[model samples]
Target: MSQSTAAGDAVQAMMRAVVVTRPGGLGALEIKEVPVPVRERGWVRIRVKAFGVNESEVTTRKGESDPEVTYPRVPGIEGVGVVDEADEDSGLRPGQQVATMMGGMGRTYDGAYAQYVSVPAAQVIPFETGLPWDVVGALPEMFQTAYGSLTTGLDLRAGQTLLIRGGTSTVGLSAATLAKDLGATVLSTTRSPDRTGELRDAGVDHPLTDNGTVADQVRELMPDGVDAALELVGCSVLADTLRTVRRHGTVCFTGALAGQWSINDFTPFMIPVGVRLTSYAGEAADLPADVFARQLEAVAEGRLRVPVAKVHHGLEQVQDAQDDVESGTAPGKHVVVLDD
Candidate 1:
C-alpha cells in the first residue's frame, strides 16, 4: 500500500464513501468504509472536501447513464479538494488545492463521492481560492459545460445576442453570467414565469416563458434572430431554438434537462439554412486553470455569482443532496461538504 499525506497530515487507510451497489432509487446510495484510493504513476489522489450533485449523477443512479457505469461504483462527476498524493512528474504536489471533473471520473472508476478519490493527473485542474468549499465545488462541471458551449460550441463574441433555451438550470444560469461577462446580450427561457427573476439575477437581459415553443417570442425581441442559442431542454425543443437564431448563427446542444435525448422523424432539413449546429460535452481540460481562478476571484469580489441552491454537510447527507437534485425542487447547484 502506498502511504500519502494531505497538508502534512497522514492519509488514513480507510475512508468514508458513498457506494452504489446497483442502479435504483436514492436508497441505493450507501455510506461505507472503503479503502482509500491509491494513485498510479499518472494519477493524483485528492482529499475531497466537497462535491456537487448533478443530473448526470442522478441518471447514473437510475441506470440511465452511459453503459460504462458498473455496480459497486462511487458516483460524483465533479469535486474540489487538496492533493493527497501525486507522481513527481504529474506537475502536482501533495497539499496542492485542485478541482477535477469528467474524463470518466465517476463512471469508469471510483469517483469523488468519497473522502478520497484517485483520478488521472491530466484531468485535474489546480486552482487557488479563498471561497467556501460549497461554492467552489459547484463550479467544475457547470462552468465547463457553460464555458465550452459559449466559446467552443458557439464561438460567441462580444455584443452578440445569445439565447439560453433552459434558463433556470444550473448550467443555464452559469452561461448567462459568463455571456454577460463577455459583453453579450442574453435572452433566457423558463417554463414558469415565476422563475424569470432567477434568470434576471443571473444577468439575463430578457427572460421568455417557454410553453413548448418560444421562437416567435424570441424573434419578437430580436427581429433578426439571436446571434447564437444554447439548447439545454433537449431535442424536443431544439428545432424551435434553431428557429430563434439568425441564418448564419450557431446553436449549441449541451444538455437534456427535459429528459429528451433524441428526436424521432429527424431530418437534416430541420436545421435552418446557414445556421450551424454544434454540441459541447467537455472535460476538466476544457476549462483553463486561469479562467477558473479568475471566476473564483469574481465570486469573491461580488462580480460573479455561483447559484448554489443548497449545501449538505458530511457523507450522510449525500442521499439528501441526490434526492433534492432528483426532485428538481432546487433550482441551482446542490453541494455536499465534508469536514474533517
Candidate 2:
C-alpha cells in the first residue's frame, strides 16, 4: 500500500488503485497510483476500508455490459469507508462512517478499487454497526438486492413460498434469511451436495441439489407449487424454475452464471399456467434510511449472518479475489481489504 504524503502535499491528491487493463483473468490487473477524486458539490469522498466482490461486477470487468462497462476501471461494487469530505447539503460530514454501492461500480466510475472515491452524497448509507469492515462491505449490494426482490419486485407476502436458486451463494443465502424473517416458507437449491444440510440450519427448510430435477423435487415438497422463485443461476435452470412455480407465480432473475438460456417453453405455456417471468436488474440506489438502519442493526445483532469466504489485500489482489468468486471457491462473500 502507498503511504499518504504530508499535509498540503499535492502528491496526496492521488491515490493507489487497481486497474483492469484487459479482461482475460487475474493477471490482467495492476495497481498504480492515480489522482484521488476531489469532492464536488452534492458529492462525498470516502477513504475505502474494504470492498465486496459480486459475480456480476466480476463479469462486468471481464467485459460484460448488461450494465455497460468501460475499460481501465476499478473493480469493487460495494464498500465501507470513512468520509474524507462531505457536501453540506447532504447532511453528511467528514469522518463519518458509511457504505456505498450501485450498479457496476468499477465499470461505471473510478470505484472501490481505489483508496478514495467520490459518490453522490445521497447514495452513501450510514451505519452504526461497528461490524468488521469486511462484513459491512458485503452488505449493501446483497442486502439491497435481496430486499428489493423480496419486498418490491416480488411483493413477497408473509406466508408465501419462495424457492431460491444457488441457495449457497451470498445473495441466495441473504434472501433466505430475509424470507425466513418475513414468515415465508423457504426452499432453496444448492449445487453442492454437502451444503444441503447447512442450508436447513440456515433457515431453508427444503434444499435440493442440482442433480435432481428442480421441478419434480419442488412439486414433491409443495404439491401446489411455490408462489415465487428467486433466479440466481440464470438460464440453465430457468425452465425448471418456471415449472416449479404455481399459476400466476413470479420468478425474478437476478444473476446469470448458468448460461443465459432462452425460455422456449414459456411462450404459450406460461400464459396457460399463469406464471410470470420477471427479470430484475438494478435496485433503488438509496434505500429507505430506516430500513437500511435496521439492516445494519440486523448485522450487528446477529440476526443477519454475512459469511465471508476470503479477504485479499487491497486493490492489487482484487483479481485473485475475482478469480475466487468466479471459480466458486468463495462459499460466501469475497472481499478486498483496502486497509490493515
Cα deviation at 66, candidate 1, in Å, is 0.7
Candidate 1: worst-modelled 10 consecutive residues by lDDT = 1-10
Error in Å for residue 257 of model 1? 0.7
Steric clash pairs (candidate 2):
248-274
Model 2 lDDT, residue 252, Cα: 88
lDDT for 282 in candidate 2 is: 63
> Candidate 2 regions off by >4 Å?
1-12, 261-268, 284-286
Q: For candidate 1, lDDT tens digit of each residue in 1-340?
A: 3456766766658888999999999999999998988678888999999999999998898899999899889999999999998988778888989999998988999999999999998889999888889899999999989998999999999999999999999999999999998899999999999999999999999999999999999999999999999999999999999999999999999999988999999999999999999998988888999988888888899878798999999999999999998888889999999988
Provide the global lDDT of candidate 1 against the true structure.
0.92
lDDT of each: 0.92, 0.79
What are the models' TM-scores?
0.96, 0.90
Candidate 1: TM-score? 0.96
The pairs that clash in candidate 1 are: none
